[model samples]
Target: MKNTIAERIQDFLKQFPPFSMLSKEELLKVAGQIRVLYLEKGAYVFEQDEKCHDEFYIVREGAVGLYRNSENSQNLVDICDAGDLFGLRIMIIKKNYRMAALASQESIVYAIPSSVFKPFIDENKEVNTFLLETFATHARNYYTETEKGKRIDNTISIDTAKDLSTLRTISYRKKPLTCTADAIVKDIAMEMNARKADAIIVVDEQKFPIGILTDSDLRAKVATGLFSATAVVTEVMTAPVKTYAKKITVAEAQIALIKNNISHLCITKDGTRNSKTVGVFSNHDLLVSFGNNPSILIKEIKRVKKIQRLRYIRKQVERLLTTYLEQDIPTMHILNLISEINDALVIRTIELSLEEMPSQPTVAFNFLVLGSQGRREQLLMTDQDNAIVFEDVEEAMYDETQTYFLELARIVTKNLHAIGFEYCPAEMMASNPRWCMSLSKWEEQFRTWMTTPSEESTLLSSIFFDFQSVYGDADMSNQLSDVVFDGVNKSKRFLGLLGVSALQKPSPLGFFKQFLVEQNGEHKDTFDIKTRAMMVLIDGARILALYHNLKGINNTLLRYEKLASLEPNNKELFESCAKAFRVLLKFRARQGILHKDSGRFIQLNTLSKNDKLKLKRCFKPIRDIQEVLRIRFQLKTFM
Candidate 1:
């Protein structure tokens, strides 16, 4: 009489997407045919290249690992935890499974046959749309346009299911002021003044955007006397305007403006210049959306002649970080946005420093950020680790050039300190004469470090090897990277030394699975998460990436993702390491924000049971990844 099991299935299914969009009756009908299956860890629900099972499955408990096999190895594409849906590909195509689904942990899963789900796809638009978005997100570049269209009609929509506030649809200026291409520049300028508008779109007879004219256009062309005020707008207007659909998200709009190097974007009906124009999205529009708008802060950083103003902006950045963390925004998104803002601060500081110089140096040089900041992973207001590398000058002029850059580095680092980044206690900064050098000297520095590894050189290499150019000539950074990789590629002894450095940090957990807190010093009875947990992952990632010669990838999370792709045999471990790193990073940031410090050391007693469990969960991967490094580098003898 009572189908309690089916009813329970509906409860779980309705909590997730696609099924969440389905009506009660529809979900019930689908749940009625669902078959509940239990899987032991390492058991596969579906195998790659096998014929579709006429069913799609969802994780009801534990986790499922989706793997794509290639080159005799299975790569983890994605891990689906509780309430996560997988196996949707069967509903979209009549082909074999492109990926295999296996239980990553002992799990319970619900399988709903396509026969019961196909009718709902045809009948419900929301369900269809949700599935379409899910498919696009998880697509591995294999699905054809026709195959994708089989599940839903072609229509682009912003994925609001994501957590980032920037992903929300933008509130752009509707009913934009428009003008014809033939309108006189004087008339357009006068009209813009009367309307108090900074910009106007140039539209064709059919209202399709052709170009745009802004105050900048008038200032550069009319005020500069390049064109007469009475000249036609076409003579001065910026042609080939960038257009996006009305549903463009703030993130998309921001990217369009930045990438195009424009102040405004025209919103069109069909997302093309040929389509009917609807509204305008200006740089100002972004300012009103988020209180701590990154673009606006960046603009302010660049515009502020005084360095003290940057300190205020940096404070706002911390507030933004707090908001993102409180709102549970994706950690990777937070990391990237903060990195960009931090970089803007450093770049602006460098720009202002150059202005204070007696005269511009003649040779090309690069301003590099070392350590965490260099990897684009710095979150909180941390210590500054930077260096300077200038073009090699004739031996006679070398001293003069080095002195100029050293002075420049001193100013930049000092200003950066004012903006909240503390000076590195080890004095590992650009201002250090040993760090500010010519390109050839820097190359030699890396060669020496790689050719002959020691405690001091290894420690310095750990910081300097992650150096990234935040300002100045990027070619210099690339050249240094080439030398480092060249030296590392040939040095087995150095790899072993680095591997030893990674294993130096003991396991975070003890024999009883209890956290190993600090034993003495000022941090007594506290946990040094940075050194024990985060660095273990960071070091493992860096060493593996270096061993694999993965150039230009410095961010810890990205390094792990790239490693997973490159070494599919160890994909699960790398993916776990990446996930663990994200969790640990976010945890540290939250702690730092709460205590108003770097969040490096944690008082274990302060943590709630759940918080402690989450921290412990992240440490397992740290231990597992360390073992991989030990075996891979043959560190037994060295240790």
Candidate 2:
């Protein structure tokens, strides 16, 4: 007869421990021979002098007290929580029980037959390591002077940035209150007053954070009579609010607050501005994260007057970035703050360059940042990809205007290199005469690329299309965006070609469910995360955003998020892509910081079981989105 109780026992065991390492067939066999025992509070499961039992026990519910006895006195050693295992020492050593087990509360435990479990212990490395760590932490710790593992303690903290690798996790105010962007200031202020909260994040219909309103806004903008109290939140709230994903520690949270100069930060589901709000942090949370002095760095950046000063400052920023990564700050948050610092460096370099010039420019021009700078997802110093888009000039004066702008671009790019940004190998910077052009010329170039997409055109446009105006006339950049999107809107054939470009990288996994790694050359057997993983999401987001006509939103995570809101039926899939993009970004940044290089090619053998699982989980979303793109654009027919 089939044993339903044992099948249920196997199900519970599979989610936990060394049992999880066993095959379903093997686990069921072990489960079939196990015995279930129920005990009320203070009931003894085993005594100190009991003979060895063939089975070891796993607590399914409540808690068990493991006590050490000496001279007619019992010392409570440890409280074993749910999923904790005990009575394994006797089975391994073939000795009598050394300690007594009693129910601290009513509990259910499964006694596993050791005869059926020994083979699995010898076979699985992860299982063996886990069991050894468990014993060393639980059994051996109770015998140590400090007795660290005798209780579940999470109050550890490391203060200095130098020692940040061991910092503790900081808690946040979870499930924070939020209002939509459409809400009026007066109503939201009343809600804030009622809740006694200092700030309220303004979200969109999907609860995606768009901006934030605070008591400061009420005082500075409303109380001063600058804006009416009945004005909408969008009219006053600070837009592009700083956001973070759920897993942050004391060190990461502090850096975020000081770096952004914000008293409060919006914690969201994906740590991008496009995700639903989940929690919030303020100056108080910074204190909780063990506040470090960050004013020095900010003062330097703001007061910087030379290229060498910024070069020195860039090193400090790298150190700060290392600490944040080591402390496990969410990648999205790090990207947001670090990118701000990078942009400031560019803007400052541009200012200093203009000061060195003989006079102000003859016409308004914008420094168009491209490549990773354009995406705003850059984590490390990479090649500069930029161009110059100046106001249109009379054809007769074109030669003069081009010469003036080229000279200006030369100084700006040179200063940027001194400030640590590497020069583009392909001369893609504004310093290249080809990249510096009139606004109308840039518009014509974009129209040409979209209407006639080829391999070379696709490669060049992929970097150029994500152009962001770092400094100068912001309005000029807006005009360029409208022109590019307008051209894309006119051609279904172009959209299909862009869709085909997105599918250029196939699945990141191969047969045997292993990462599809570089087969030969310098990075043989190593994973190409940038080309195979990050690019997939980045390309997908760009094409989708263009299709939906979303402009000025360059970050891939925000792109997927905006896509999710626009298509509710595909929201889950889109959100999954966003989450996966974040995980990959974080993973790459961490690897980069660890190995002191571009974290592009990753060695697979270095990863643990858990790390592999996290990386593998991201591939599913990548596969799903590519299929959606293929079917939607009918790209297979073109292929």
Candidate 3:
């Protein structure tokens, strides 16, 4: 009864439902009465039509397969892995087991008493909904129509007989009316009316779309006397119209609309404004083409009320990103759009965690996204790096306040992992006690790092300096940034140390002009594009920008642009760096799409002759930029 194995089982069960919804005492009670069942590969826990056991099971280790018995064969319904719950349908409905539960591999499962968990199913709405949904998905896949009606009367699952992929690709109207920028507003309105359209594209003399004249533009700019009816279309049109290339998927088109808060996307022969206009994609068209819209995704995220539903949405976003890349959408635009959705997921996870807390937070707090995510450049699913900054509290309440935030951060980060963002391998997440801190303590920590520049301090500074507020009080994050920049402004030595740190990777090219590759570990024999190439540019940009007290600029390309403006003498060098960085990013994005990994590793054998040459071309600017960093910071002495 007092075995460590029982305590381990309790710990595992305490995270999942209906066990999670139970009080600690009630959970331990069930835990005490639990039996540990170990089964080898291909062993069945219970066969179809067998009487229900007195308890349901949670997979503690390995895998379990839930299979349905047909007239002639058994069909696999679902695979249950670690942290997944199974065998609960019988306990919930009080019926004979309709499906056989078998261990797909050597497995350990916790058998929790049905009597102890039953009360929680009635009490926790979220737990109940989760169980019902899981049962519905399994039943829809396995059960016959007759069994569905009788076995799960209250369950709701869409069992439509249509290919979901086909539903997502249905085409819509694209031939929209167009007018020259110099055309009169009244003529544009007439063109819209004549074509039976709600909007008219305003193009330059080259036939490239430059602006749009929609019904709202007409009412606000023309009908309101803000502009004359005889005014040129450019006077009333929305300039720099959102544009997309031909062959965009319904998901990309919808995401564009939501991100820009626009109803239409100007389709061009090429994606930029320099190309001829081809067609138009409207929000209405996207809705008709794909039944699901951005609002539906947001609604789903909110309605999730559980981590599993959020995981499903995250998978859908991955599918969306894959489609976007296949269609050759701009990487910057894709990064911005996907990062927004990722931020929203983190925000929602925080909201859900708050609900799970026993009470509201004792004080206001801000959630900070660090490293690549903070810079809004995370394209692939990477480890999450984050920290929490809470408002200062009295000395008496400091320890308890910190404890509360740590607990909240744990829940938030765990849920983030469930949604596809891997846990930070270095433990840089908010869940780490060293990171979850009060504002004053964080300020002191930053000051310590800035004033004393050790190898570890410089490394931590490089990561923490890029912090962005993903959720909570923006003022807290702004204050922390102010503290960081103020410290850097005073410590010239520290800035030089940062510059030296940024130069550690050297050039990404080898002596024979071959691409430099990783030396060891899991990624041995691979080229670490992120550490060797991308981070060199990113770290250099951050250090130089901070030295100049630059603000509101994070992207490496944009930082170079700002630096060019500040240092006219080095304008060409900076501009070249900007262009090379963009080219390298595009290359990495394309490779990531092809390999479905982080794009950090490159297979030299897979590269075409042209790609290898193009990659080599970018290395020149990388070497030149490192030289410039060395001179400007006088890093020769440190090296």
Candidate 4:
């Protein structure tokens, strides 16, 4: 009397959407009517233009690729993986199949009879909405204008950045050739010939894009006999597909292609591989849309083989920065975009250095950027702060390993210097043996710094604690973060010491509420905004974040935002800190650009009355946050 197979199928169905909306009793009843089918790679679940089946399918295992036949070839529309629903089109339209569904791998599927599932659509509102949305997304505009539930947007907006057409939405090839991972190279090549297409995307069974095969791959692999035509496309395909969202701008697409040195990009619904592939963007697309502009400057930065050309590109970026400021773009937006550009420069520099090395690296490692650049808040070129953390190795190989990475770092830092970033005066660079070490050694260093609680260690912690992994293995960096939080948990004295350090910077304003100006050096009459104001806020956010054990939040503004969420009573004060930090950072960036130097000092006389007032208003949050740190850490006793 027990239907064991139906119960198993029911259990699997309940884990996914639509079915998840069904009651236990209802799901079991539906499951009893379901039929199970087994399929091998290349087996067809259904073929294009075939009459509708009596049931819809859900992949219980492996992947099912939905391919639309076009121009004598098949183009993959979407992939359905485990728990992913397919064959739903028949349920809605009661029409013939518009695409073929084939198993991309050995698979098991559950066929849920539409006769049983259709009642749920009418009875359960959640199931109806979910299925409709899923159907709409996968339809890829297959529905005509007269279709039910169709709505049009009449809203229009003025174009401010019309000249910057790269900001405009990209138009890509919607019908590029795509095939399953198990598809044959020879057969796909024949299909390409039939369609006169140059590229084919290789997708996984679950419909996520996994790799790409192009004419170049065929010439190098099949023509040269590196691989036989009968071989699966995965053998020669360029893998781990680069995916972008449908909303990706032309400029972003161009840079993404150039930066990764790839020719094609998969445009997905959500800009990640987890979503279905919607279209493909290629170099051919860029050729028409491309113009000589900021994006071109960035593209040149990535393409230039020589380090000297990078310096020229860096100058162009400065001009771009000026133009952005003049355009009055949001400061945070500018910060993020320019920071990405800066990161590109650094990442390219590392790539070039690796190529110049006599031999390849032996073990996994991570390149870390520290201080402002690490926080992704460096809008203006400042001193380079970086380090290296390689995977732990045997004691015997330590010296040689360190020497190799240090040499690599030496070249990278030298290249970065040539590209406008100055070297750290204190030598806090990966080239320094003290900063470049194995992961375990780095962990030990943090543990020692926290347990000892010295002034020097606290200074180093502040600098190094904010590190962001720029290249290589990110897991190494994550492990380092784990060590940092672990060390913080074990040492309360270090926490108090860090708190005292945050409070060490005096109030940005004097007792008379006047701007605190430097009394000595070249900036004698100018306010030391860097130390007097920004540092107070930065240190306060950093210390508070560590006290609450907030990991991975390094940017001062973001730190305040996260802290506000954690303590609602202090939310107002914390949000003010984030707002003030943003204002100060923008002010510093603007001054830096004007002077063509590090924006640390600001002359009080150059500002308008309102500018001066804005600066004073931003400082109140600094005083308040520092006081919060003092009381939270009982810093009065430590002081």
Best by TM-score: 3
Worst 10 contiguous positions by lDDT, candidate 1: 153-162
- lDDT per residue as tens, model 2, 1-639: 988988988898886656776789888998988888898989988988798788888999887888788888887655565566888764345657778999888888888778777777788876665565344223322121123333312212222222222133446788787998789999998999899788998888898898988788888999999999999999999988999887765445655654565678888888888778999987654442332223334444666766766775665566567656655766666777678778888888898999988978989999989978898998888789999999999999998999999999999999999777889999999999989999999888888888877887878878898989989898888998998889888987777787787787856898888889898998999999998888888888888888899988999988987899999999999999999998998889778755556789999998999999999999888888888899989999878
Where does candidate 3 stray beyond 4 Å? 1-299
Ranking 2 against 3 by TM-score, winner: 3
Candidate ranking under TM-score, highest first, comes to 3, 1, 4, 2
In model 2, where is the ten-residue run with the lowest total lDDT?
Answer: 157-166
TM-score of each predicted structure versus truth: 0.58, 0.55, 0.59, 0.56
Q: Could you give the candidate ranking by lDDT, starting with the highest? A: 1, 4, 2, 3
Query: How much is the lDDT of residue 405 in candidate 1?
Result: 91
Model 2 segments beyond 4 Å from truth? 1-296
On a 0 to 1 TM-score scale, where does candidate 2 land against the true structure?
0.55
lDDT of 1 by residue, 119-225 (tens): 88888876675565455334423222323323221111112212224446788888999999889999998899999788999999999999999888888889999
Q: Give the clashing pairs for model 3.
A: none
Clashing pairs in 1: none
Residue-by-residue lDDT tens digits, candidate 4, 493-578: 78889888888885678889998788888778888888898988888888888888988888887888899999999999999988
Consecutive 10-residue window with the lowest summed lDDT within model 3: 152-161
